[model samples]
Target: MRIDPALRALRSNPDSQRIAQTALETCKSGWRSAEGNASIFAELIRYGRGDELGECPALSSLFADLDRAAALVEDLVSQILPQIAAHPLGQVPFRHQYSGGMAVLQLAAAGDAALSLVMYERSGDTPHSPTICFTDTERHEIALAGSGTMQIVRRNRGRRAPAELSVSSVEMKSGQNLSLCGMFETKRIESVEERLVILRLGRTGAAPEPSLEFRVADGELVHQASGDKRDSCHELMVSLLGRMGRCDAAPVLAEMTRSGSDHLRWQALRECLALDTATGFTALCGIARNPADTLSANAGSLRAQLIEAYPELAAFEKTLCLA
Candidate 1:
């Protein structure tokens, strides 16, 4: 395999190169081993009921080592990135990704512009703590070189309310990075990949520029508003809060139904239906009557899905959002 030019250059510093090689190998070994054992872990989980997981020593030990291995590799990566930035990347754009249970790295380039990512799977110490109710927080930091824009969105499809997803952004200098943080309730076991951050870079002014701008056309991934307890209401949050049986969230759901993003409006309507079918279906009928391009399309798809799932919801499809 042809070594990355940047990696080849990194090799110049003997000690730094050694650290990078060792970290990469260790991370790879642990991730592969975890993947191999995943099926066995899942099987063991199904063996019994409440105490089966905590009772298994193998499961507990494996989770502990995976957490340790990821932290070690993450530290090594932190050490290497600063060195790479000290020396400017070459004009050649490249993309490299390394995925493990606890972390994943994505690097892509287009001539003068490049995007590199280090995603960590936020892990908890007690994988056996499903017995108790608790909350966990997550945060992300992104570094960009040259010029670009970034969008950070948080979506919750679980029982807890969505924390109003912040539309905050930051400008980056050649060596600077941006960090954003927020907290969410962790009442249930959520997918490790739930947190998403998309980084977009300005075109490098090269001919036939790559589509460097980030896009999220798929509306189905819509998350409820961020229910940060203290943050301002985000429209999506209305539905999830309602799901928790908070009647005070009803008016919030009403406001969310009028959002410009039809994707959001539709989801809000779904929440309304669960809360008060008459009013929610009424809003749905109104939206369907006058649909736009992307938003309307999302509304229609969701309408079909809901109707299919609950045949009675079919009555509301034509009368609700799409009309």
Candidate 2:
């Protein structure tokens, strides 16, 4: 393939290289000293309160300051687009290419709050995503250019509320802003008019509840993921200990089964069972017998399956019954 003479010169010439490098560095420097970014960073640290806090109260303030964040994004884009036009190799730093033909340019992040500019291209003939996912953080989005249609859904509540979700369609026009709670609401881009650019500000801190993914048609829970970094790490450790056959860790796992989220408790119980059946069986039986335990029904079902698979477990079942 033959390369264009100008493009080749831009790639090889020392003068062109210096100009491209200077353009990229200028974008980064301009963003660091942006007017509103320092205040946003200060707010993130103040309201983040470490990861131990369940929810971020800083989200409310971030949503209210959407225009300030928009101004920062506008300033950053003004510095970046010109350089890209001058040289194809010149681009902003911290640009992340994600799935669905979308790109995210992280402008600034501190503590639990992050500001990003997202660019979405119209996916011609691409089918809509069958699933929608939500995390524990809260977010605010401002459309800087182009337009799109968004589908939003939230949990229905009240004494007589039905099991179905309350769904709504939102027109995401240029200059519009939206605030959403991942704990209670989720939004999906249904269609883009052309190319869409948005300024998104969010609290990256995890809430008490885990992230969830659900099927749009039936609202079936397809996946659950822990938002807490420590919980995820603990889960990995538990799996490792179980695979290593560390029966000495059974006591620690036993204690873990009594605390934390329902999912974590169940995970600890499972790893404990794999390492030591006797201890695990006793804990399992205790959970199954407790009507107050959230995992009681699941534990009871597992206990039945175990007894059927191993006749020796029947003796343990009989002993528990007698006790």
Which structure among the candidates has the greatest lDDT? 2
* Candidate 1 accuracy as TM-score: 0.27
Tell me, by TM-score, which candidate is best: 2
The true-versus-predicted C-alpha distance at residue 271 of model 1, in Å, is: 1.9
Clashes of each: 22, 0
Instruction: Give per-residue lDDT, candidate 1, residue 20.
Output: 52
For candidate 2, the C-alpha RMSD (Å) to the true structure equals: 5.7
> How close is every model to the real structure, measured as TM-score?
0.27, 0.72
- The reply for model 2, stretches above 4 Å from the true place, is 1-30, 50-67, 78-95, 158-162, 204-206, 227-229, 289-292, 304-323
Give the whole-model CA lDDT for all candidates, comma-separated.
0.42, 0.75
Cα lDDT of model 1 by residue, 1-323, tens digit: 99987778677666765565555545433433454444433433342222333465543332334343233335435645554454344221224454442233433232333323443343434243212212222222332223333334433424333222223344433333333222221112233333332232211222221111111232232333322322223443664577687665656676667654444565677777788766665655555545554455555666667678878876655444354
Q: Would you give me the overall lDDT of model 1? A: 0.42
